[model samples]
Target: MSTTHEVTNQVPPLVGHDVAEDPALLEALRREGAGWAEPELHEVGRLAGSEQAQEWGRVVNENEPVLRTHDRYGNRIDEVEFHPYWHSLMDVAVEHGLHGAPWADSTPGAHVARAAKLFVWGQVEAGHTCPISMTYAVIPTLRANPELAAQYEPLLTAKTYDFGLRVPTSKQGLIAGMSMTEKQGGSDVRANTTRATPAGDGTYRLVGHKWFTSAPMSDIFATLAQAPGGLTCFLLPRVLPDGTRNRMHIQRLKDKLGNRSNASAELEYDEAVGWRLGEEGEGVKVILRMVNNTRLDCLLGSAAGMRFGAVQAIRHARHRSAFGSVLVEKPLMRNVLADLVVESEAATVVAMRLAGATDRGEEILRRIGLAVSKYWVCKRAPVHAAEALECFGGNGYIEDSGMPRLYREAPLQSIWEGSGNVAALDALRAMARQPETVEAFFTEVERASGADARLDDAIEGLRKELSNLEDMEFRARRVVESMAMVLQGSLLVQHGAPSVADAFCASRFAGDWGVALGTLPSGVDTKAIIERALV
Candidate 1:
């Protein structure tokens, strides 16, 4: 035996434990009326924490999806080839009904339970959730036309993973994608020049190029184009009802910074047949439904990233030692770990609350709260991920440590649904357009009044900011940040663990924090917050 390769002082692999064991996740699950789903959630958690599942995540990322524009016989197949493990990962996602099942579920808090499960399993891999979320989101938009919804909703919500290029109606289940942005209009979807013409019947012929289309291999897509009336929403499938391929050109797959496991393509639609999902000029209105749902997923995915980083950082500290003492026993390291746990917990609780709002049909609260949280929580992810990775020192910088992957995936959620400015502006827009949404948001925040003085004062300050609408757009980020902190503080004060809430109020609301992470004030209950992560 070689004494040099002893592997001493290394943290053991984190596997075979339930990722759903966290108290905050479980507490939110119950509070949101999804306690009945605890057993099912644990099942998902166990599989997500398995070594085999972890390997599936790693293998797919290493072997990115390959684009197959043609067959051996020179036929334009327009397909994407993923590593076998990618399908395995997607199979589990579909089998667990993470895609569109919640829309048809009779269970109480269906969306909330699904959101919690997504937050749990996304820790395994973050990319595949993109299509799953799209499929889930497209259901409502597809309902803009009753006939189309009736024809496809069953297959869309089916709990089966039918992976292939086929007629969407014949497939037992379906996966969906979204294609709207073009080079001319990045976020300004109205500038889309993709023109659509009526074919005398109900179908329309679309001809234009998409700058970015996620999950290109999906059975169907919710697309936008300029129709005779104006911008319109339509449902386009890869294979037509007559069993022939649509006139779609797979230009090229994007070389992205991360999320390589999922295929994003530049596509040209050459008179592709599409059925209008909504009336002409209502494309933006219809597609916003899909955007809101995917935004919820952005929140979940970022929270899950936080959880992944915290678990890895804490697991390493518990075992590895320096200065002849365990890292967890050191004072400074403890503050860092506790702060990470606090951030993760705040994100999880608020995300689940929004999910619960969706389930309860509290549209006012969801509309405003999502935009606020999306701006603040997602913006925090990259910073949180960097701090967590630093806890492992040089070791975390390596690929095998998994911290690099987490760090790479962190910035995506913030960039995906909407960037910081867009999200913050959305919150302000919601406040102005739908004054009731702003009222609903504050009503929820005011629940914990008198429970914590810092929270009460924060709420008061937030009100003052809202009253003075001067320079609102310029101060959008600051106003949204205040709203997010107050809402999170209220939730923690009301439902979260006492120590976690205390730490959140002291550092986030009161002026007891530093600019960077791991700067919680002294005398805070570091031990208590860290134990919440351990459980």
Candidate 2:
């Protein structure tokens, strides 16, 4: 006997929908004063949600980059060959100004607008954003050396993206990468043994091995090597001014668990030519600018992951039915979906708020705020992905469901730029070194203090925690988490719906929830929150 299976209750393809059209994101953008960029964001959202974009994401991952160490003639030419889809994605991102739009256009709310575009584009493919982010971040570091900035800034900030290895002068545009980590020093750049010997004309010959050099095919890179003065930042170009390739050799490509579409290489600089970016012994200070910008991107990327997962899960629940009722109508399922919705919105608000601070030049608030948001938002992503996946039952576990990709991508943001411990410690350091930062952070959070009693109480507790300095390092994570919760609650109270803010405060601040999801108290409007999250 032969049996035939019929497809009945499966959800249809979620295509032709604009991710930028998400109500929570639009609301946040408006709150941040970036609503002027809405039409462009809507276009990006349409592309991100299109069927072609989805296929490109899948195909790029399926066809991982190929490392070509040399040609058949045996010349030393190190290159990475990517699938055409990867270049297509890069083209779209560059054309849309995802690489350096904010830096190029210094209009009001430029950073916030760029953040929104990145949040939308990241939902389609994340790997290609690595080079784009590095290119965007290198601007501030490059500005430290005006000569280098004059030489490279135009190329980096150009609207076009010229792919493949080529001379910077010959291309219409350029991208950049970074080589920071060594085999011995993972996050400690001071421990690096790369030696830089002075060459003529303020240049140096750097001989070192970098363990992780992402987007190795880029036209230029910002790296560090020890000089006579101390550890210093250097700008290394792939092609020399004489129209020859530099001595940078690709040893091998890393086999990462995710982000397979982008190539990360272990490289050796055999006396590679490098130009000093800042005064000697100031590499840490100079690189910190780039690191902080990348850290913000990490926060945005994680929030985008949460939005993607929630949308997918909610779409499935709304369509799938069991026990004679649609899954979304089920009481327990509504609670779970609402929990996911609240988390996503909290992340969105905090990320946008940080971007707004950047635009307003609130340096003190940005310092501590970045660390807090980076720690909490990235830490929450893995759990968010897991819960969203569970909402799809067996189908989510399958590769075709797209949930596994999101789950694999969730933990990366926490590990990248800086891990949770690193961010938490940075927060503590900010408080110790610049006590004014704490006051600034509180001032920002206090904007919504009177709106909710529970949030006010949480803010008071956080203040008390800040007063005690003993054992501060050990309790750093807890304190940061509290700061994050209070800040998120404050934003929701100020900009979000009354029901959303009430739900967040009751569960996150007032302790009306449980460890597991689907435990919001009975009177909360779970249905409304879930409906808003459904894209």
Candidate 3:
């Protein structure tokens, strides 16, 4: 007798669902006053979680961008070629106004809505967001030079996306990129040696090399160069007004560990034509506007990663069986999934709150709040991804499981915009320079003080830490972590389900948990949390 093995208890592919339709996400949006945009967000969610989007992500990363520096006739033509699927993904993002939607729309919840869209779309493919984020960030910085803004704002805000290499004057739409760090100065832009000589009428000829020029094929870039005064910001267009290529030479592309779909190039500018932005020596002040916005994107990206991981883990747990029971029914595995759900929900809530702050014109709150969120949310992503991947056991270790990609993509958020140390220092600087920022941060946290005793205790401890200035920088990371936890606890107590808040406070603050995942204390409703996270 011949016997055949049957495939039972295998999980189906997670597709054909609308990610925006998530109950938690929709509730968060409603709480944040952006529920009116649910229809549009649902469309984006559907597309992002679709099989086509998954295929696009695979093909784009597999076929990385190729630099074609010279044409067939040996003439210099700096361009990077991407797979058609990459273009399709970009087209969808651009059409949805992910690039400049908030700036273009002046409604009450514009920023919140745009952030939600980005969060949803980023879960599908994160690499293409390089240009989208840069374009969105460039608006405020470009305003420093009203002349430049007048010349390009319409083009940048245009809903259409022109994916051709042409003069900005001829293109229907445009995207922006940034080149700040140099070989000697990774994050210290002041140490850059790039020299800019005055040409004529606020224009300069820049001659230096940029260590990393993200989205190298973008139509324009905001770069830093040394001028007569000091390091200054300049706008460099890929194609000059006369329809000729700029003197920018693409030396080579960096082989990165992840975000492979985007091209990060090292290029030398041999007297590249550039227009000075803002006054000389004010580059840091001007470019900081752009950095702040990108920092917010980094936070949102991390939150999106967490959500993706949590959903995948929950779905896998519900389907796969082990030890004569489904993983979701296993006590320890249930605890792990529930812990991740709490984490993902906390991140989503904090991110939306920050966006709401931006909409409310809470400048001080936004400044410090962004720093706190950027530091903590991005930092938690790698740990969350690892735990989620472990739920699939051996299958998750393979590339086909999609867990490895999420894991690899997790660290980039913490590193980009600003590293953990940088974010913590920035928070401290905000406190020193603007005491009102501290007040704003505390004011937001104190709203939920009386709701949870654990959160109240954590906040009191953080207040004590903030009072002592001794070894502040040395203790910055610990202080920042505490601040992050207190903030998350406060938000959960105020907005999340009672069970979630209790679980978070008990494990995170009351010391009922160990150092790893799956250590939630007994009596917590782990099954409910897992169900909430399930797709």
> Which one wins on lDDT?
1
TM-score: the better of candidates 1 and 2: 1
Q: Which candidate wins on TM-score? A: 1
What's the ranking of the predictions by TM-score, best on top?
1, 2, 3
Deviation of model 1 at 282, angstroms: 0.6
- lDDT, candidate 1, at 101: 91
Worst 10 residues of 2 by lDDT: 1-10
Each model's TM-score?
0.99, 0.98, 0.98
How large is the C-alpha RMSD of every model relative to the true structure? 0.9, 1.2, 1.4
Name the lDDT value of residue 89 in candidate 2.
94
Per-residue alpha-carbon lDDT of candidate 2 for residues 1-535, written as tens digits (9 for 90 to 100): 3345666889898998888878878987888888899999999999999999999998998899999998999988898999999999999888888786688787888889889999999999889989998988889999999988888888888879788677887899999999998999988789999999999778999999999997999999999999999999999999998999999999999998888899999999999999998989999899888989898898899999999999999999999999999999999999999999899989998899999988888899999999998999999999999999999999999988888888988898898877889889999988889999999999989999778999999999999999998899999999999999899999999998777888999999888899887788889998789878767
Error of 1 at 442 (Å): 1.0
Compute the lDDT for candidate 3.
0.89
lDDT of 3 by residue, 9-78 (tens): 8899999998886666777788887888888999999999899899999889889999999999999988
Angstrom error of the Cα, residue 446, model 2: value is 0.6
TM-score of candidate 2 relative to the true fold? 0.98
